[model samples]
Target: MTATTEINKIINEDNLVYKKTNLLLDNEMHYCPGCTHGVIHKVIAEVIDEMDIQNETIGVSPVGCSVLAYNYIDIDWQEAAHGRAPALATATSRLMPEKYVFTYQGDGDLASIGCAEIIHACNRGENIVVFFVNNAIYGMTGGQMAPTTLEGQVTATTPYGRNTALNGHTMKITEMIALLPGTRYVTRQSAETPAAVRKLKKAVRKAFENTTEKKGLSFIEIVGTCSSGWKLTPTQSNEWMKENMFPFYQLGTLKDE
Candidate 1:
């Protein structure tokens, strides 16, 4: 066999232990190196591909770091106003009852300006999946303090570190969502390690399955890293998230009913 043919044979599907999901487009992702958005996106795409729901899924992404999520994920996408993804997703779910709908949002977009929208959508039992990526600080617009920013964490707006007395306590929105009666499932997860990535993939699959079952709402809070925003290397960002974000956010399911 020719050398190129031999190499191609070795790289064929039967020998391929892993490959990128087709649900993820070839578009180069805009996320910074070490950012967790790309990882989370991959997990979601894999879940949809595994479930064979690519054509039946619609994703909504609002303003924030994930505003361009549609560019990477190969699915029907809707762009909502900043902090309004949940609202748009609610409408989409209602309009297309048979299709799966999901919202990809960031801390600043979901926990800040769009807080009310999410709360109401969950309360109303929207029958959609919500992927809430929390890196604590505002990543896209510049490293600013976000609603989920941890106490004592420094940011562009909080160079002295977040002070509860002045800045207010960080919001544990996932816990709050779990308490809402309209929500059928809510969990906090991360993707800093291989095991963690597996767990995250499972969570993503469950959330999409919930939607398929006509469950009210599935909220997956992915406590992620913002290396550039944190002014840390990817390794440092993962370490810092483990030392800081995990303790406060705490992984595991908050509710599954």
Candidate 2:
């Protein structure tokens, strides 16, 4: 046998278990090391690839760390103002009812400035999926405290840690939206572990599937870590998230219908 034929035979003997999805660009992601955004992006891309919806999928990228998502996800994308992704998604989905539309947003944009837009979109049963990334701090705009910032959590705006007595309590936007009649699915997940990644992928796939089922709305809240913003290494940030963020936010489905 020829050397080239031998090499090709050996390569074919090994089964490939994993490969990067083409739905994501070859460009290096801009997310900080230990950040879950990269993982979340991979999961979303995997789902899009598996569902064969890349050509039919439209994503709304909101102002935040993920504002550059359009650069990474190789699909139709629309940029929205800080916290206005839902509004844009609503319009896009309405105009192209056959396309799968989703919004990718962070805590600052979704829970703080764009809270009203999301709330009303859910209440109105907009046929769209909302991917809410809750890292608790304003990652893109320095480590500022956000609406979902945990009480006693230190941030640039809250140097001494968040004080509920003065700042009010953390906003549970996912829970609030789940209670709306227009919502069809709502789940809180994380990507801190291998098991969590699998669950997150399933949740995302379900959310995407719901868009085609004529569901009013689907919301997936990913409780993620911001290593730089939180002043912790990637490893330490995951530990901090588990110990701090999980207690209040909790995991699992808040609603499903």
| Clashes found in each candidate (C-alpha, N, C closer than 3 A) | 0, 0
State the TM-score for model 2: 0.91
User: For model 1, where is the 10-residue window of minimal lDDT?
Assistant: 1-10
lDDT of 1 by residue, 1-257 (tens): 11111122236655653333477677777888999998888899888888987778889999988988887777888899999999999899999999999999999999999999999999998999999999999999889999999999999999999999999999999999999999999999999999999999999999988988898899999999999999999999999999998888899999998
Q: Model 1 clash pairs?
A: none
Stretches off by above 4 angstroms in model 1 are: 1-21
Q: Tell me the lDDT of model 2 at 95.
A: 91
Q: Residue-wise lDDT of candidate 2 within 1-257, one digit each (tens)?
A: 11111112223455734333477777877889998889999999899989988778889998889887887778888899888999999999889999999999999999999989999999999999999999999998899999999999999999998999999999998989989999999999999999999999999999988988998799999999999999999999999999998999999999999
Alpha carbon deviation, residue 247, candidate 1 (Å): 0.9
Shift of residue 107 alpha carbon in model 2, Å: 0.5
**lDDT value, residue 257 of candidate 1:** 88
Q: Candidate 2, after superposition: displacement of residue 111 in Å?
A: 0.4
RMSD of 2: 6.8
In order of appearance, the predictions have TM-scores of 0.91, 0.91
